[model samples]
Each structure stands twice: as C-alpha cells, then as structure tokens.
Target: MASGNMTRQPSPPRVFVDVDVQRDFCDETGALYVKGSPNALFRRLTEHAVARGIPIVGSVDSHAWDAWEFGSNDMPAPEGGKPGFPDHCVKGTPGWLKVEGTLPPRFRFIPNVPHAPIDTAVRELATGQTHGVYFEKEVYSLFANSVAEGFLRELSAALGGAPEFVVYGVATDYCVRAAALGLVQRGYRTTLLTDAVAGITEAGVAAALGEMQAAGVALTTASAVLG
Candidate 1:
C-alpha cells in the first residue's frame, strides 16, 4: 500500500520513516506538546507498518544542552527545558527515546547520523538492502540545514532524484511542513500524510495543510501513506 500521492516514479523501497517521534515531539509529556499529539491512532498506524515487516525508521528530536538555533514559527527556544513547555528529551536522556506505543521490536534507532552519511543508508534502503534511515533533527526540518554541503548532497541522493517527496511528523505546520517544502524546493516530489500528523495548535495544523497544498505538496491521509 503506497502512501500519500503515489508518484509515477519508481518506489524508493518500503522505507517506513518517522520524523521526530520523540518525547520532545510526539509524547504527551514533551517539551512542546501538540494539541492532539501522542495520538493513539498515529501510534497504531506506525505499529501496523512495523508489524508487517516494513523496515521502520524512527527519528528522535535530539538536542544538545546548548544547541538552541532558530525557533519554529510556533515554538520558541526555552529558557531551559523546564521554562518553555516541559522538561524533556535532552540528548542522551530517557526522554530522548522514541514514543513507546508506535515502535516495534525490529524498529532501528539511529542517533545523530550526520546528514552526510545518510546517502549510503538511503541507497541501501532504496535497494531493500537495509532498513530506512532514522533521521533526527534539533530544530524544525532536517533539510533546513542546507549549508552542510555533505548533508545537502546526501539528501539529493536519498530523494532518488524525484521531483516530489512525502513527509509526516509531529507539529505539522512547524516541523513537518518545513521539511516537506524544503524537499519540494530541492526538486523532490512532495506530499504530506495528513492524518498521521498533529499540531501544537488548531490554527497551526490548518495553516500547515493549506500552505502545503499551496506549495504543491499533496495533502493525504494515513491510509494513503500506509495503504
């Protein structure tokens, strides 16, 4: 079952990738809890994929103590983890683990695999030679860090030279949307798994979908992504 807007281009293998599904992103006790996050349904969707022997790629929203960069449209940097939202997944803490319910026993966790090294992982994933890349990001989108030439080149390679990409994750408008559009600009076929994502606010969720469509990122449901 191909998800999102099925591209005419060849399938890039069954890479079941999840972005920032960490305590700081998808968990209810996360630093910045989205409105409907920690959603049971989203977890179930992931569980379904993993149970089917799909190579699961789980991303954690990892951050260093002093790693505050720019802020998202909605979430600003915390005075500390406590002051902003909730004390949460600092790098190397228990809170940094993936959201429990969505994970499978076979799900592989890759921490801070610098974007430079992602190309080989992506090639292996595309060839069904390995599980997909478990991508992490400190801020919004993984692609936002364009200055890293190594990362940029790797991303270009992972996208399989396609004109569009499909993405889904926590905080749709802020993080997920940024990643999707970023891929779009990089000339990848872009889409969003609408039902699988949640936002920190109702307005943000609506805004994300609207903007995604406006930017030519197809809006789709989990069924589309998973089926």
Candidate 2:
C-alpha cells in the first residue's frame, strides 16, 4: 500500500534510524571494526526515543560467508566476489549481533533476507502494531533490501506521514553513506548523527560527511537529538 492508505495518529516528529550497529562492525575485536562505539550513543537515543514515544528501527547486514564483500569466498558468479574488505557480519554468527547497549526493547529488527514480501510487510505495518522494521542488506544501502522501497512507503504510513529520519552508525564512508544517499533518493529527509557514528579513517569520514552535506543530509550531533 501507498503511505496514504493507512490511518493512525500522527507519528512522533523524529524517527531514529540505527544503521549496522553490529558487533562485527562496532566491537573492538570485530573482523571489521569501525574505530569507535556509536552504541553508547545509540542506547541513549533509544531511551530518548522512548521518552518522546518515537520508534527506533534498526538495520543489519546479514551476509553469507561468500558475500561479495568478503575475501574468503570460494564460490562462483554472482554470489562470490570481493570489494577487498575482510569478511564480516556473516549470517548465523554471534559476531553479527547488534553491539552492546544498542538492542534495547524499544527497537524492532528487519533482517536482510534475499526475499521479503513487501506487500505483506506493508499491511502489517499499516496495522499500527509494529514499532519498526529491521531491514537487512547484502549491499551497502539498506534501501537495497528485499523489501526495497516498499519498506519506506510502509514505514511512512506506520509513522502516520512521511518520515524525517535521524540516521547513525558504522563506518561513515561506506554503508552509512550509501544508506543516507539512498534515503534522499527515495524522497525522504535525513539527518546524520556525527557523534554517534565512526569511520574507517579521518580522511574518509571527512569526505563522506562532506558528500552527505552536499547531498542535503543534515549533519548533526547525537546531543542535538532532543528526543
């Protein structure tokens, strides 16, 4: 369903979108750790959201051992390749868990599977019973998940209007950048929390933040989130 079909109270003014805050990316000993813990701020955001009564939706990267992002793949064709990053967030592993202090009871998960029935998810979301969807992605952009744009459409409905997303998490240069840009492309307003996110390198983070600003994604700090 399109966003207009759902009936509900107007959503809270802010929507907290927590991107891959997984152990594999946020933990100190992770296979592909980002340099810091956004989870500490992420936890505060979750509690803040609850205080304001807003929803917190989290996205995770659930990949096969042979996912294109990994170097350990020994498979063939579409499923096997690498962009030169080390293996991380492999499916069915503890390393893939959301980092400590990030998975509060307020959050809802939408795992990245190869397939998700968008229409069904939309219907469920429209019922006003779900807090949020935990989208999963094999690709960097969460928008590339199996639910595709339908997730946003439904999410808008669930929130009772178009969403104004406050996004944070992981390496500032790659997945986080892709997700922020994707949200803009899909016609949503986005805000990136600087203090709550980390990067692979200082240069990379600066470049990514510059790019996001140029693309109209508001650059702000976690402290700025009043909720």
Candidate 3:
C-alpha cells in the first residue's frame, strides 16, 4: 500500500527502535547470520544508540522447534533436527542469544538475563512518565502480527497517546522496512534508521529504502540519532 503525510497533523515525540539485530542475525558466528550485519557501520550505529538515552526496542524472531516455518509433515528435518533453508535463531540456543557487548552491559545486565525479554528490560523505565517505551515484533512488523499489536498498544499507551517511531535492524529490505511502514500507517511519524540496519542483499536494501522514502517515512542515520 502507498503512504502519505498530512501536514495538518501535529508531530509526535520520536525515539529509536529496531528489528532483529541479534547475534543470530548479525554475527558471522551466529546460526542464521546475515552477511551484511557484522559490518563496522552496524556496530557504530548500535553503539551510538546505546550512548544516548533514546528508547530502543528490538524485534526478536523466537520460535519453538515445531513451528510451521520449519516443521511440516511432508518435509524431513535437516541434520541435527534443524531446518535446512535457514540455520539460526533456534529457541534456547546460544545462536539465539543476543550479541555480547552489542549494547551496553546495563541493558543486558539483569540477574536472570537468559529468559528476559526486551520489554522487561525497559519496562520499569518506560512506565515512568519521562521514559520512552520498548517492545518486540516477532514476525514481520511489530504491528504486522496480532501478538506484536498487543505489546505495541501497551507501549503506546505508556508513552501517552502519540509517539514517533524510528526503526533500524538486520534484513532491512524485509522486517525492518515492513515495521517502519506499519508504524507510519498506524499514524505514527516514522523514521528509517538506515545505518543501523543491514539487509540480506545490497539490492534488497536499496529497493526497500526507495520504497520507504516514497512512502513518506523519513530516512535517518544513526549519527543523527546520536548527535
């Protein structure tokens, strides 16, 4: 669908959020790593966001062993009982874990970090009047699927009635772009944090960025978020 901006609408408060930029997606050592994710640019973008107090949300692709995307009666499982099409982000595996030191220790430094979701990490601060909210988008856009919408609404309500969402992450052409577009359609001012994101392919990234621009989502860089 096409997107447009209406000039009369009052601008809302803005913050930075992202799709799956986890170890599984971004690190070469990870199971389902994207080729573009481990670059210095992505590190820089993530580092910059950590330095600022901007509320950062991340979408994680978590699934059980029997999910339809991986398991079907007709298809046999790959070696080690894993799927063949992609080898990553498996539930409870090290590859499924977030990258070490990607964000500051504070973000990941909980008593029980292994089971904690991103929402829990930011919930206390986000609930406070001055803090920005955080949420997770498991499937496509955080707003694309039903589960994500529940969390999105809770976060939105916490941050008052209106909020501007800036997005970044791995596989820019697909998940990241879709989430940003979804946010825009929901009447939020959306920005694409280009540098912080990586795509499966260069062409895919280029095309998605073009589509996002055409849709009236502002294209922004991590540097802009940092400074």
Candidate 4:
C-alpha cells in the first residue's frame, strides 16, 4: 500500500493506533480469525489515513514458533495465548503479516519479537522515517511492549503536549479494548474509532465498549476523527 501525496503531519497530529489487523485475525482461513471481521473496512480506513495524512502506529503480533502458544516443547500456554489456541502469527510466516493494505508503504512497520534487544517501537519512532510508528507487541496491549511508555513519551515530547491516539482495529473485545484503556491509563486522551474496529462477539464488543467509556476512552467514529 502506498500513501500517495501524503505528507505534512497534522498540527497536534493525531496518532492512530492500529491494533492487530493481521491476517490471522481477519481472515477466515486464518488461525485465529475474529469471528466476522473482514479486511475490507480496514482498507477503507487506510485510504482515509492516506487522504488525511494521518500517521498510523500499526501494531502486529509476532510470535516465535517455539512460543508456548503453540504448546511447543511442553511449554505452558504462551504468555498472551491460551491453551488449545491454534498456532498463528508465527515469526516469518504469512500469517504474521499485516492484513492487506493496512500498512501503507509510507508507514513505518515493526514486528514485536520476543527477547529482541531494544524496543522496536522506540527505534522506529526515533528514526523519523515516518510520522507514524508501526511496531510489534508480544502481548495484548501496546503497554505490554517494553518501550510502550517510551514510545508514548517520544510522541508526546516530539509533538508537544500528549498526542491523542485515535485507536481502531480487530478484536474490539480484547486487544482493542486493552489498547484503548491502556492509553487512557497512561494519560493520553485515547479515542476508539467505533466502526473501524470489529469484534469476536457482539456481546463482547458491547461489554468492552462500555468498559472503555467508563474508563474515559472517547468512543468515536473514524469519520469524526479523520474529518
């Protein structure tokens, strides 16, 4: 995906947190498809970003094959994965790749690998390659990544005042919920783009959204945020 004619980050530019819009979570053929999610809407959201020059912090889940999630080596369930969970997003595999068009070429990308020295998020944002920081996460929330606080701090210091992270993506009940609430907890005014995210279950989505609202996470739509 190319971000055509997209430049000039918005003043008090909005930080878009794209959480786990990966093949494994959005594709029916994937190992952990999120019930009814399709990548179609995410593609539209990507186009909206390119048109709006909104820098996106794209996050992906990268797991090593030996990760306990796969039940490899008799290891207990991976820290973030559950027992009996099908092996998905294994490092260097197609399933590990971002969902189609979610990662525009102009966006910086990071794969959250386990035990990798240095925070991939900090390194990517520090490079200034793109206004957006795309990094990997080993856990459900970006905060679970070692450099999460640092990454948020970098954005805040660079942008002046804390950057408001406009978040969206798959599994609204889980990763999306965690990211939104975590951002709020970190003191960043976080907004969860309602329509941009999909969930594993309707009941779960409702519950998560309710919790996020109570936690002070602004629930809005992409149109409202991007406009």
Among these predictions, the greatest lDDT belongs to 4
Query: By descending TM-score, how would the candidates be arranged?
Result: 4, 2, 3, 1
Off by over 4 Å in 1: 1-17, 44-59, 69-87, 101-116, 145-164
Candidate ranking under lDDT, highest first, comes to 4, 2, 3, 1
Model 2 segments beyond 4 Å from truth? 1-12, 76-81, 106-108, 111-115, 118-128
TM-score of 3: 0.70
Judged by whole-model lDDT over C-alpha atoms, candidate 4 comes out at 0.73
Each prediction's TM-score versus the true structure: 0.69, 0.83, 0.70, 0.84
When 3 and 4 are scored with TM-score, the better candidate is 4
lDDT score, candidate 4, position 69: 55
For candidate 2, the 10 contiguous residues with the lowest summed lDDT are: 1-10
Q: Model 4 Cα RMSD, Å?
A: 3.6
Candidate 2: tens digits of C-alpha lDDT, residues 52-164:
54556567888887776666664444644446568888878988888776665533455555565665555444453444557877777887776657767676775667678
lDDT of 1 by residue, 54-141 (tens): 4444455666654544232234445545233344557788667767776554333444544344555544444334434555555667
lDDT of each: 0.57, 0.73, 0.59, 0.73
Residue pairs with backbone atoms closer than 3 Å in model 4 (clashes) = 112-136
Give per-residue lDDT, candidate 2, residue 180: 88
Model 4 bad stretches (over 4 Å): 1-9, 71-73, 77-82, 111-128
Supply candidate 2's per-residue lDDT for 23: 90
The backbone clash count of each candidate, in order, is 13, 3, 0, 1
Compared with the true structure, model 1 gives a TM-score of 0.69
- Model 4 agreement with the true structure over 12-72: per-residue lDDT tens digits: 7677788888889888889889876747777777767666666577678877777665644
**Alpha carbon lDDT of residue 115, candidate 2?**
61
